[model samples]
Target: MHGRIRTWGPGALVLLPTVLLLGYFVYGLIAWTFNTSLTDKHNARPVPTNHVGFENYVNLFGEERFLNSLKNLGVLTVAFIVGTLIFGLIWALLLEKGVPGEGIFRSVFLFPMAVSMIASGVVWGWLLNPSQGDDARGLNRLFSILHLNFLENPWWTGGSRWTTMASIALPAVWQLSGYIMALFLAGFRGIPPELREAARVDGASEFKLYRYVLFPQLSPIALSALIILGHMSLKLFDLIYAITGPNQFRTEVPSVYMWNTLLRSDMAKAAAIAIVLLAVVAVLVIPYVAYTVRQENEE
Candidate 1:
């Protein structure tokens, strides 16, 4: 027993630094943020601030901008997820059905996944500029060349609030659809040809086979995509901010809200927002992580 302990102790010592760093820097910071949220911390004040006990939270909820940010988040998240999932599934299915140049198509579709959201947003911002006439740009230019003016609309800057949020999601969907496609493609390939053949022999048509059997088998893949895309969309800040540049009229989300709030010395409000954001993330992530861990343990 003593010898066994000694043997693993060295390895434990080696890993201790990383474990301590994670526990302190990661979790400790989260704990501090939560603590800060419970108080009335202001950058304008001295180093120490007085306890306010959820006043910041109440105030945050009362703010019109914060509420609008929440609404925009919901709009963007749903639009991005559904659009990406459907588009990816369709592309993956087409590729699986034997396209003329499958490898080339796969590479092309996956290329967007390699680009950063910031870069995609910048490019798409240029493409989606809502200006008209002499200053018409982005996809509007394409619409003009193709004589498809009907298809052109104010992408990020024009339209109703919900529509504007959904427009912001378009670039995100385009960027992420390729990743979702890769996920679906892998899921499809992982499915056994023998299983498909058995279904065929059982007199199931192509549509029915996929509708019943293959679709059910791909549930895990779909769930994985949902979890990933949901996480990305919920906490999104960089892309939207980079493209829109703090456009208060539209395209604001909680993280950006928090950033602006913190910048203005509203530390308590920012921390409250951060805590709320963490809660949302935890709600999405905890279940998935637990499920994955359980599956691994069972396996």
Candidate 2:
């Protein structure tokens, strides 16, 4: 025991502050938020008092707006993940093939990631503006000039709810596709060139080589990206807020709902919504973390 303490004591001391800070600020806040969700607190008194159990959560589920937010989240998550992965993989494959201006193109693809989500939202909001006739602007104006007026229509402001959510997802995909491309490109580069040669020598066509060998090797990278994107989608807020603002129910998500609920002094309901978001993120992330840890241990 003495020998063990002598070896580890200094390291433990050095990590103590960081551990305490995480304990208080991270897990501690999660516990506090969960506790608040179980109470009957309101804006006038944001503190928890009457223990109402899961009443707030029950009521949260009953709310039409909350249900709609969940549906919007589902639509956004599917569109964002599928669109990003497809586009990212395509970019990675094109880059791997040694296209001309490869270095410049890679930098151009990644530039959007340098811009903030709010900025992308503002820009896309204008591009997708649905105005027409004399009032037309953005894409509508461009389409009018090109005489392809049929392509222009109301984006998030006036559209089918699912389509609106998917439209909102486009900006997110544009922002993150480059990062995903880098992940995929790194995965491709990490595989030994000999694997490609072996597959080619075995009479495999180029498409078959990628389909049978390279793509399978990228499963780990894909899973990691899926988890990351899934969690981000579940907690999405800022971009939607910047584009649709708080009133656009078609684009409303749980985070936005929580903000609106909190503003209305419904503290318990907002806490409940927050806890729901946290639970969803945990559901997506915990499995990936476990899979990663198990793989590390096996290796």
**Best by the lDDT measure:** 2
Model 1: ten consecutive residues of lowest lDDT: 129-138
- Which runs of model 2 end up more than 4 angstroms from their true locations? 46-48
TM-score of each: 0.94, 0.96
lDDT of 2 by residue, 93-191 (tens): 999998999889899989999998888888888888878876899888998899998877787777687778878998999999999999999999999
Per-residue CA lDDT of model 1 for 251-298, tens digit only, reads 889999889988899888899999999998889999999999999999
Clashing pairs in 1: 127-138
